[model samples]
Target: MSERVVRPVGRGFLFLDSHPAGCAAVVRRMAAEVEPRTPERRTALVVGSSSGYGLAATIAGLARYGVDGIGVSFEKAATARRTATAGWYRTAETAALATELGRSWTFVNADAYADTTKDDVLDLIAGKLGKIDHLIYSVAAPRRVDPRNGETYQSALKAIGAPHTTKSLAFDDGVPVLQEVGIDVATDDEIAQTVKVMGGEDWARWITALQDRDLLEPGFSTVALTYIGSELTGPLYRQGSIGAAKADLEQTALNLAKDGVTAMTSVNGAAVTQASSAIPGIGLYVSLLHKVTALQTPVEQSIALWDQLTGETPLDLDDEGRIRLDRWELTDDVQSAVRAQWESATQDNIAEVADAAWFLAEVRRLYGFDVPGVDYTAETEVDVEWPTTA
Candidate 1:
């Protein structure tokens, strides 16, 4: 068979953000090129392991850094429609890749919002590794199951106005058409329900359960992802129910430290993962951030997280222990620029400001499939393996 040389220029294709491989790429770059680490396999527990930053962190912990990890997620192998969600396929593919690289990858399709998930993980750790050295919390879900009552609590994202309009490229035509988005005025009870579902409650539960099981070892560090963006995303994210949940997460990090998981922390990282896309008004912000950052910083310089947790390079600290990924992007200067441009942006001005078209393409490329010249039309099945209980 003649080898098909498909050189992927960078991250995923526009509009399609493949969380798994994009995450894997980030981890590989961070571990090897950006923040280098000592090469010894360690045991890790990664919740939300099938998607978004959680998946990326998992890839870094397992594949790139060669850490053995147990991933806890409710990622269905196939979505309700029987088609693979981006996260489901990505996680499955990533687990296979990690196995080939000699790293253990366990994927548990249990809800992270459950008490039993942690319990089961601890049981596995006891049988195989006996302890978890590092824990990474990266769960992004629109709802949660009450492990207490088994009631499903769903969350809502605040959309702009009664029904606001935004621009998205019609895949068939590259033209940016204004898309109208609906606002779901979540009730007060709904807000509370959302918070309980997405907030730090589940995080605390996980930590407590692991501690009760004595699965967390000394020097055990943990970090949960958070995002506090500028005014643009306030209605949809920062001031929304999800934002409130994130605030709770940030607070939980401090409590985790005070309680002796001193190495535990929270990361308010960059704004592009799958989780961000679900939020309203984020596409514009992300497009702007990517555009401006690319101009202000070189591609390698844009490798923000690489310099933080991984001991590869010197650390860059913010006022808090949290990494300043979106903070800088959402700064007064940057946000102002983006806000002004967003106000005046017409389809004609897209290429000038930040191509929403390009944004979609990059997101699609994360699936490990294509760039313009890369052909994946034929089925190429690579036998994949996943961690089994150990």
Candidate 2:
């Protein structure tokens, strides 16, 4: 364990946060963690696995456990100012390294939301690996496009018709700024568009296609991450159009976590991924959770997520059958404390606001900035590769 380095190595390491680092550490476990669950080659697929917890999961799957995998990242691209996104380069580098272990890795630049890309995946799997033992869906997009209507979906961060303001931290500097952001009331068309994109329809389609192609091993467990935020974020998360989408995701999980593919189950992984950072006010939420988890909770995220997937105890976090990572921060006591603390953030009396400079800076650090050892100004060209024909 001491020799292990976290996945997506060197560039924007996963779970670099100050707490229960998720899959970053667990994937590094020995042959037992990554060894095939079946006699066939143990192949895995990661949808939206480019950044955040998804990429971390990929690292755990490949770099750590020696399990080969195919990555499906939506929204993030390798072309960064004519180069690759840091996460892209990180993953590409990982695939390059895993080759030494004789474990294969490939990445597909596709929108997990689209059927065309879905077909591309089926073809990819059919041609090369022959079958899949596990599937991890970790893609989250704030906006969506309707395939049928050609409309765009933009989610609201505030209540419909409400103009709420809050204090925000700048990702670069550890400075707090007041933001007067409002929720953009989505049109009916916009709502439908968002639902179609973030909803479970695409996930369902992928599973059906894989099954038809005979790509799935019976009893193959499939997990799609979901978040049921505390009531504090109801307007933007749980009770909004996005909430409706999450409901769809949970429902989709129930339907998709079936087929008796021998082992099919979907896990609503507790929220802590690269995707979670982009949402307004969410950084604070994540940081607060991390800090609380770090301070009072014995459970760490990296161990929690991995254990839930392979634990002897009941894998479901709640009665809902969702595999909630045992994040003490997300529990009621911590959430209530954070909620009260959040309500305490005010321009007039900023003292009540939890001093989140450390947390905010750490969030920035997740994407390769302000980290202790990194030199951002240096011209470094990282190497990356796409899996060949496989």
Off by over 4 Å in 2: 1-41, 75-82, 144-173, 261-274, 295-303, 310-313, 348-352, 382-390
- Write candidate 2's Cα lDDT for 54-132 as tens digits: 7666665554345566888753433322334545544554555567567777778777766677778878777767787
lDDT of each: 0.60, 0.56
Best by lDDT: 1
Best by TM-score: 1
Q: Roughly what TM-score does model 2 have, to 2 decimal places?
A: 0.76
Model 1, 12-97: lDDT tens digits are 22332223334344334433433434557578888887656676566655544567878887743422222334555566666666
RMSD of 2: 6.8
